[model samples]
Target: MKHLIALATALTLAAASVLFSAANAEANERYGKQKVVYHINYDGGQDDKKYRGARRNIQNHSNAVGAENMDIKVVLHGNGLGLLSQAKTNEALRGQVLELKGQNVAMHVCNNTLKGRKISYENDLFDVFAEDIVPSGVAELSHLQLQGYTYIKP
Candidate 1:
């Protein structure tokens, strides 16, 4: 009777462990495969509360879902292009942007904004490549949504 009871207890513990591990893995997978976009269009400088909040939000999202397990993009246009402009002069803000980029977050700028603002990526922005310039910010947002990316406005 003692032997049988011990065997049953051992089996039960093993089963519980397996079930817990599987559930944990599934939870990770759910977050890991998510595609999300962080949209910024406000016309505030880097010191603005709203702008800072948006950056915090992006970092929080990446923290919740492991950055490597997610596809994250930040669409910058309109006043949002301020980040690029500030990055040219602000070392702290530039460091943060670089950190996010290092974690695989793609930061895009609108070409229309560049034209309207008379800003050149080469002269005004830091780290933005020509390829990262989209024709229109709103249109790019719409296209990304169509491609199943969840949009977040911070």
Candidate 2:
């Protein structure tokens, strides 16, 4: 009976491993070619660790799907503007953003928030351009969803 239980456990583990491998392969092959939008709202990430996890999530997504296979964007609004708020003084954070950009990830900031905060992108954010400003971050996210981009709020 003990041997039977051990064998059962081993088989279950083996089956799980096989299933995981197949799923990972499909992730790398099938839906790797996908467009994804990551949404950020200030309220969710109350601390740096949570925000950093979100950033790491994006990098992991790229790693899983292959950066070239993904057209990714990070959309920030409301208090989420903190995504770039400390960029000037935070070299590590700035470097992470740039690395993702190097992978062709676009970072979108809400123009509405910028206006409300009295920020000029040219002078405020670490590495932002006029093209990166979405008139409304939520609306942009909705539009991207409409256009078949998978939305992830990390």
Candidate 3:
């Protein structure tokens, strides 16, 4: 009787462990393949609340979902480009943006903004790739949504 009871208890424990691990694996998978985009199109210059809010939102969202498990991209155009400009070129904001990028967050700028504003990527921005620049900001947002990326208007 004692041996049988011990065996049953051990089996139950093993079963519980297996179930718990499986559940955890599934939960991780829920965000593992998720694609997200954060939009930054405000024009408040350096003192813009919405611009700051958008940055905070992205940080919070990445924190909530586990940045490593998420495929995240932030699209900047019009005034949203200001955030990157401040973060990249400005000595004060550079560290913050670099830390975010360290967590696999990619920032894409709009080519139209560059052309419209006559901004030179080579002289103006940091950490942006030519390939990452899309033709139009709004159009890129639409295209990303079509590609199944969840858009957050932060």
Query: RMSD per prediction, one decimal?
Result: 7.5, 7.2, 7.6
- Sorting all predicted structures by lDDT, with the top scorer first, yields 2, 1, 3
Q: What is the lDDT of residue 27 in candidate 2?
A: 81
Q: Tell me the deviation in Å of residue 36 in model 1.
A: 0.9
Cα distance off (Å), candidate 3, residue 79: 1.2
TM-score of each: 0.79, 0.78, 0.73
What ranges in model 2 sit over 4 Å off? 1-27, 43-47
Against the true structure, whose lDDT is highest? Answer: 2
Q: Write the per-residue lDDT of candidate 2 for residues 8-116, one digit (tens) a residue.
A: 9999999999998887788887765889999988643445666688889999988788777899988999877777876666787788888889999999999999999
RMSD versus native structure for model 3? 7.6
lDDT of 3: 0.78
Q: What is the descending TM-score order? A: 1, 2, 3
Query: Could you tally the backbone clashes for each prediction?
Result: 0, 1, 0
> Residues 63-153, candidate 1, lDDT per residue (tens digit)?
7666667898899998899887887887877888888898889988999999998989888988999889999899999999999999999
lDDT of 3 by residue, 49-148 (tens): 5656766888777765666678888888987777766656466466667877898888888999999998877667776778778899899889989999
In TM-score terms, candidate 2 sits at: 0.78
The C-alpha stretches of model 1 lying farther than 4 A from their native spots are: 1-30
